[model samples]
Target chain A: SQQGEEDPQALSIQEGENATMNCSYKTSINNLQWYRQNSGRGLVHLILIRSNEREKHSGRLRVTLDTSKKSSSLLITASRAADTASYFCAKAGAGSYQLTFGKGTKLSVIP
Target chain B: GAGVSQSPSNKVTEKGKDVELRCDPISGHTALYWYRQSLGQGLEFLIYFQGNSAPDKSGLPSDRFSAERTGGSVSTLTIQRTQQEDSAVYLCASSAWLPSTDTQYFGPGTRLTVL
Candidate 1:
């Protein structure tokens, strides 16, 4: 069963615009990680935010976690056409190695 | 270094037949996982293996779904008596099992179509 739920099933923005996506989960998590998938390929790890972390930035990507609200958000700055793909938020259970992933947010960057 | 790899990037089989999907994780990684993704859907966790310990099969959906990792390097997922609902992309991933959160490297995935 999936532990996370992403909002705004799809989002479209012009190049250079910033895009934000949100995810909410049901149970306590050891950590939350984001991944990107292009077309039909496998997913690539993007960023990870531990339960203790509130915010993290990696290059153009910024992520914020709110353990109190049981939610997280991913922000992409100066988005480009290359950023068009599906983004997923996965939750790692506090005491287990299993990762339950959300349905994902499909982001389309119009050139 | 080579990333994780899976065999038969695409597989088409008839219902009631059996299919085996393979995954070769990055060298020296101690953790591997299997997930199933239906069309335009989130991945469903199927199973997990960590080091030499017993695998965690709690996520498996049915008795027909089974997996095995040989020598802690290569793993295979087998679906017996395939059903049409079994059609989906089977993805494999591996992690280094670090002290904290570990990032998983994935394979291209095998697209299984049950006719």
Candidate 2:
């Protein structure tokens, strides 16, 4: 069963614009992570936000977590065509070693 | 300095045949995980191994699926009597530890196509 659910299954935006993707999970999590996957390739870790933290940033990526709301959001500033890939949100449940991933949001940054 | 790696980037097998996928995690990493992603679907957890502890096999879908991590470094996932529904991309990942805070490095998945 899936724990996280990302909103806006697919999104298209112009390069240099900001793109925001949202994710909501059903259970309490130890941390939330976002990853990007190029076509026919592996996923690359983008950022991680712990349950105790509300927000984090890495390069052009920003992640916000709301434990009470059981949701998280990922923002990519100044999007590029390289960012045209599927983005996934995964959560590590408390005390569990495995991560449950959500149906990813496919983002297309048109050049 | 190497990242995780998997062999046979693509595989085509008959519906009744078995298949084995290999994953070599980053050196010194103590945690390993396997997940399956069906076309247009989210990743489904398959198994996890942490150090010397027994692996977590709860997420495995059926008795036809089994996995093993030998010497705590390399892992293999075996599917017996594959079915068309078993076709998907099998992804492998590893981390320094089993904690939720640790970032996992993923390997290029093995695209298994059961005919």
- How well is each residue in B1-115 modelled by candidate 2, as lDDT tens digits? 9999998899999999999999999999999999999998888989999999999899899999999999999999999999999999999999998658699999999999999
Regions of model 2 farther than 4 Å from truth: none
The C-alpha TM-scores of every prediction are 0.96, 0.97
Q: Per-prediction count of colliding residue pairs? A: 0, 0
RMSD value for candidate 2: 1.0
lDDT of 2 by residue, A33-93 (tens): 8999988469999998899999999999999999999999999999999999999999998
DockQ of each: 0.61, 0.78
Candidate 2: residue pairs that collide: none
Worst 10 residues of 2 chain A by lDDT: A92-101
Off by over 4 Å in 1: B98-100
Estimate the TM-score for candidate 2: 0.97
